[model samples]
Target: MSTNPRGPNAIDRHVGSRVRLRRQLLNMSQEKLGEELGVTFQQVQKYERGANRIGAGRLWTLARVLDVPVSFFYEGVSETLNQPGFAEGDQTPIIDDFIQSADGVQLAQAFARIRDSKVRRRILELVRTLAAEEAEAQAAESEQA
Candidate 1:
């Protein structure tokens, strides 16, 4: 059930997810971001979860602190919205969903800091192999059960 006529919408969640993604990509903790925004970490959590809507002024301030243009928050959002002139993009509306997660963000940030292309490629292969092995193991276990 929703709370009100104008409660947090899908756009709000998308924006918050972007905020969390950007903050994670910067390796910034929620507490650190909150300190920068002069808010408590809990409030930051709320904003990140889209439980509370971000106001325009706060969004402007967040843009500066997050070192991203205000438009960054709206990047994939318009794809899900059916507003006039807001359609037709190759961007997947849910693309940010994974990177917005704690694990996904940490993996991406760590992988991004790798300067050696060879090492990066090796790591990618290793991860692929591990994932494949895990999937096979899960399938085998299911069969056994």
Candidate 2:
């Protein structure tokens, strides 16, 4: 891969896009996230623009506040490292799309409102089962193709 100091790394840009997408999905403004993180909005903007590196501590805090795994930012990034910028061939992190939907936000809010541990566990189990079934179905389809 060609190294250019002025150009942003594809991984960095992708991760920044994911972070910005998630922040928007949660209806969070950069100012709000900055307030929560005890930083200026400009700093948050820099992070989102990939102009500044996000530190591990800040990433952890961002994950906690955003209700996602730290891996969420890096998901699908490996395949695009050599690309100059994110391209259509690279996987568009599905979580970003899912969480950006209105239904997704509602579902997340509803889940958060559920105070019972047992119910939460059951919900998690049900989601897992559904996801597994969907994966199996997709695999079967691909096999037939």
lDDT per model vs. reference: 0.86, 0.80
The TM-score of predicted model 1 comes to 0.77
- In model 2, the clashing pairs are none
> Can you write out model 2's per-residue Cα lDDT over 44-123, one digit (the tens) per residue?
88888787778799999999988999999997676536456667754444654565455776788789999999999999
Worst 10 residues of 1 by lDDT: 86-95
| Residues 1-145 of candidate 1: C-alpha lDDT, one tens digit per residue | 7568678888888888889988988889999999999999999999988888999999999999999999999887766465577646744544565676788777877899999999999999999999999999999999999
Question: Per-residue error at 82 for model 2, in Å?
Answer: 4.8
Residue 36's lDDT within candidate 2 is 90
RMSD of each: 3.8, 9.1
Q: Which residue pairs come into collision in candidate 1?
A: none
